[model samples]
Target: MSLISILTPEIKKAVTLLFDANIDTIEFQATRREFEGDITMVVFPLLKVIKGNPVELGNKIGTYLVENVTEVQAYNVVSGFLNIVISADYYLDFFNDVKADKQFGMVEPNPDDKAVMVEYSSPNTNKPLHLGHVRNNLLGYSVAEIIKASGKKVYKTQIINDRGIHICKSMLAWQKFGNGETPESAGLKGDKIVGNYYVKFDQAYKGEISELIATGLSEDDAKKQAPLILEAQQMLLDWEAGKPEVISLWKTMNQWVYDGFATTYENMGVDFDSYYYESNTYLLGKEVVQMGLEKGIFEKDPDGSVWIDLTEDGLDRKIVLRSDGTAVYMTQDIGTAIQRVKDFPDVGGMVYTVGNEQDYHFKVLFLILKKLGFDWSTNLFHLSYGMVDLPSGKMKSREGTVVDADDLMNEMMQTAQTISEDLGKLDGYSEDEKTTLYRTIGLGALKYYILKVDPKKRILFNPEESVDFAGNTGPFIQYTYARIQSIIRKADFDFASKTFSAGEITLHEKEKELIKVLALYPEVIQNAAVNHSPALIANYTYDLVKEYNSFYQTVPILGSDDENAKMFRVQLSKKVGETIASAFKLLGISVPNRM
Candidate 1:
């Protein structure tokens, strides 16, 4: 049992026995650094039921606890806080319980528990992914892993925007400018090649608009009359009509983008259980809108469009379908959501990993689902995150100012290489090993830097700052893990085969502190799961590493005066490394065995 579990009821019993007063709850926190206790119980909350001086009240409860519950070794009354020092046996017993258990801090999923579908990295097929997509993919993948760790069956999914004017812009531009250039011919990734055409289309459209404006046409009229845009729109219409040439072109280009996306996802270590394409699902929600209209959940505009009036719900009326009865993005999203539930019958909830700009959109969508009377609508969540900006400012995909995901990853690796070499640590590594380590450290640095902060806050990422070997970064935690691994390697004894008991060996304060931090791993995972924040896992691992480092510096592992103490400390270091690896696994980061 945890310290909290063992002590809560005991404290309640102590209060009743001593003060003849009943208490409903007990609040326990970690003892402050200046205090000489393991766990502190605030006496202020108990004061409501027992009328007395807090120090005296704490002393009475403390005295009762030490005499009765054996785990309470000692206590100190500091104003309202009753800091209780738990017995060394308690920490040792806890450590022994977990020492041999490899998967100590993770929960086993109940077979009867409902599954959760996490939707993320739903990139449009028109362009290659950018820095914003990097954050989305990392967050989504980490959250899925964390949810899985929290004992829920998780399915990772994405909705690809395959059919739209945006997609056709690339296609039309490719046909107009290319001399039958393929991705192979262009010597580029398919998405990168296609993305070039997308930018080309924009530049050409702007040039046409400028010419039209020079002819005395208003800016809006020039934009509407641009020949390039007109052709792209026509291509979209042709695609919708299932014209052979346009449909064939659309399929070809979309396949290129998918191939490119697969490579990127593989490199970035994100995966999807299923994919939903807009071409197939665009018309899905039209029927749902009709169903909503018949059920009075939605209203029809005079132009034969579908809308849900959410003004009474504190949102404006949003269109579901166009006047011509074509499905809008909202309509497609509705159908996509319902389709997921049908696809995964066991799913009881869904998390949409989208940007904060669409916060209102999800609110309105969830409300509409609830109004449409889906039982699982209440379980829906929007894991909305803010944008990632560079020091240079915002990124625009069409303008080509955006930081490409693949390029940024390479840059991160290069940065890792530069910093690692400057540190002069790779003494005997092979070329392949050095290269692999650089990529691992680079990616780890990138992921940990972004994930260490709250998801709702925008990040101004600095590659140099993130790759540092010290402080609250990925390399820091990873280096600590590596250090533990080195200790385990040098121990010369079979530490894994032996288990240490809580004998007459005296406990070091550093050892107790390290175990205490280790004990919080499971609680941290649960908290991260509840809040849908990988930041918790990232930071919790940092704290664990910090504590372990303090223990390392202050105490001896292999050279301890006592043989059993030395072996136990070595085992403790091994377990700490395992826990760090487990936590980093939840954040989709890899730890190096050497630094």
Candidate 2:
């Protein structure tokens, strides 16, 4: 039922006919915009082969396609471009096919296949989820769903960065200043509990460093002075040794962070199949390093550090193990990958949905994995999205400018509520109903904002500019869905029970365009899945809704007394509502029945 399978065959036939007619060197393409054409064949390349004027050649090809192609009702030639429009009857037939088949846009799976593992949102436990993590979660979830829709088995995982010097800082401060305070007692988020300590540590350490410098210690010496590092370092030692008190504190604090994160994930509508903790996996890196040394894949530096050579690959060499026998970040990733593969033996690919800042890191990891004789290492994919920047440049955590995930969601919801009230859309909504609508509108806005653009593109996040409710935004699409819902409710159309005349749809131009878009849902999912870009689905959904809205604005359905007119328009709206729901599902955005 995928549109591409049907249209690709049509494209190949058209290509064959063009070649047979002595037209050479032309490329056939399908476009979603500019023309109501299913396919656009750029014939400028064939102008030289035909030895004729470009426009005339285009006209010739257009005539030939319309005359010879049964799917094409007409073809328009503009500036050497031939736009072959499919028959309106064909679109109506496509709509009927989609309405009849539950798996209208989804393709049949290949009998044989490979598995894909996606790792995303590996947040540190010291802080609550933030906007950057939100982007990561949405991209990861969307990619997972899209891949599944494309008939691939996908494993979704996350590696919690639960152990490090940063964690020690939080532990140290909490031990010194927290005085038995707990999230339950303070009513603060688990991450916030740890994060308070992190901030306190910074404030205290900065002053302590300044005092040391005032006592004439050099900046470097004061910063890394023995006593200062001892407090933080002791926390790590306590954690490693599983000191009863430290272990109890760590367990309590980490559980709270996990609980808070679960709430955020629930709000965002994202889930993971497996969760990996660095507290456990950090030690795993050593085993991989030992194995690498045994296999002669890595050599020790003069300082007793294990290093991997990367100069030949046009990158600097990287450390795998430090002189003191401690594993580095890259080493932990290796162990994690190995563990994951063992967990899912048939996994053929590993997709790391981290930011672009780690592009070089993944490249080195993939190369090292390949050198270590892992064939599937070649399938390593880094879904590196760009950093979210503000009008004031990149967001920095140290400067307290990073947007917390919970706060951002609250602000978006509040904004959605204000807009809803201003528009008079939910005037009589009950408090509970209003709450539900707010969640839908707020989440839809947040998701659409993050996903409407290409992931790898650096997007400017302006509070005033980012969350537009009108053009190309989530609310617009949701509004279109709501309008369709209203239409269905008002008309009380029982499309599920009633049958319409197969070809009697008096399709309007806009209705035909909407149907064509609705027919592309499965194809869009497949493309987005392959590219690992949720933005594609987001954009497609927005476009679909926009067209549906245009059609709705132009055509009246329920009021029409004519059976064919009313039924056809109702059917079109039904298909649109169905298609939009599917697109929203792919983006991890939910549309309430009312909103």
Candidate 3:
């Protein structure tokens, strides 16, 4: 049981016995560095019910705890705080209990609990995955893992935007550009080649717009009359009509993009349990719109566009379908959400991992779902995150200035290799081993750097800083894990097989601090899951590593003369290593045994 769980009821009882007051809640925080206590309780809240001086009240509660609770060694009243020093035996007992359990912080999912489906990396098929997609994937994937660790069954999913005018543009560009070139023929990943055509489409479409503008057309009219765009629009119509040639080309190009996306997903260390395609789902909400119209949830204009007015709910009217009987993005999203719950009947909630630019969109979507009477609407969460900017500037996909995901990952690996070589820590490693370690350190740095920040805050990512071996960087935590592994390897005795008695050796201050932090892992995981944030887990792991490093430097493990003390320290070190690995796993980062 956690310290809070143990002390809450006891503290309530103390309040009742001493002041005849019944309190329902207790607020506890970590003891300040100068305070001689493990946990500090706020005595001011008790003032609301019991009228007395705060310090005197704190002393009374402290005396009660000391007399009734064996774990309470001593207490000091500082202002309105009751700082209680717990016995060394409590921490030692905690360490001993959890030392042998490898999966100490992870909880098993309850079979009766509802599952969650997380959607992320929902990239359009017209372009390859980019740096923005990287953030979405990492956040979504890490959130899913954290939720799973907190004991919920999670399904990772994405919606591929495969059918649209944008997709038609890429197809038309590919068709217009000379000798038919396939991914194999172009010697490029399928997505890369398709992305090149997307750029090409933009180039030709711009030239046509310029010509039209020179003929005295307004810019907007020029853009609309651009021959390339007109052709792309016709191509989209052909695709929708199932024209044999257009359908074949669409299938072929989409397959190429899919194959390319698979490779990138594998390299980037993200996966999905299921995928929804826009082509298959775009027409799904039309019947629902008709049903909404009949039920008066949605209103139709004279032009026949379907919409839901949410002005009274503090949002504007949202269009679900166009006057041309075509579904809007909102319609598709609505349909996709319902389809997922139908596909996975156990899914009671969903998390949409999209950029913050669509924050209002999700608000409208959720409200619409709720108004449409779906019971699961309340569980829908928008994991809206801020944009990631480079030191250079923001990226533009149409102009082809966006950082590609594959290229960024490769650059990270190269940066890791360069930094590791300069550090001179791989003297005895083989070539293949060095390569793998570089990738591990590189990807670890990238993921940790991004995941360490709160999702709502914009990131100014600097790759060089992320790979550093000091500070709160990934390599710093990873190096600590590796150091612990080295110590475990050097220990001559089997610490795992040993157990310590209650009074075998008194705990060091650093040892107690380490155990306290270790005890917080489960709570941290649950908190991270509840908030839908990976920054919590990332920072908590860093804290644990920092505490372990402090303990390592101040205390001797293998070098200790006392057998029991040395065994206990080594076992503690091993558990710390296991926890670092476990926590890193949730963040989709790999901790190397050596770095």
Better of 1 and 3 by lDDT: 3
Q: Candidate 2, which segments miss by more than 4 Å at Cα?
A: 1-26, 30-37, 44-64, 108-111, 285-287, 290-296, 391-401, 463-468, 493-503
All candidates' lDDT scores?
0.92, 0.80, 0.93
Quick one: ranking by lDDT, best first?
Answer: 3, 1, 2
The TM-score values for the models, in the order shown, are 0.97, 0.91, 0.98
* lDDT per residue (tens digit) for residues 219-287 in model 3: 999999898988889998899889999999999999999999999999989999999999899988888
lDDT of 2: 0.80
Better of 1 and 2 by TM-score: 1
What is the RMSD, in Å, between candidate 2 and the native fold over all Cα?
Answer: 2.9
Top candidate when judged by lDDT against the true structure: 3
Rank all candidate structures by their TM-score, best first, as comma-separated numbers: 3, 1, 2
Off by over 4 Å in 1: 19-22, 47-50
Screening candidate 1 with a backbone cut-off below 3 angstroms (N, C-alpha, C), the clashing residue pairs are none
Positional deviation of 217 in candidate 1, in angstroms? 1.1
> lDDT of candidate 3 vs native?
0.93
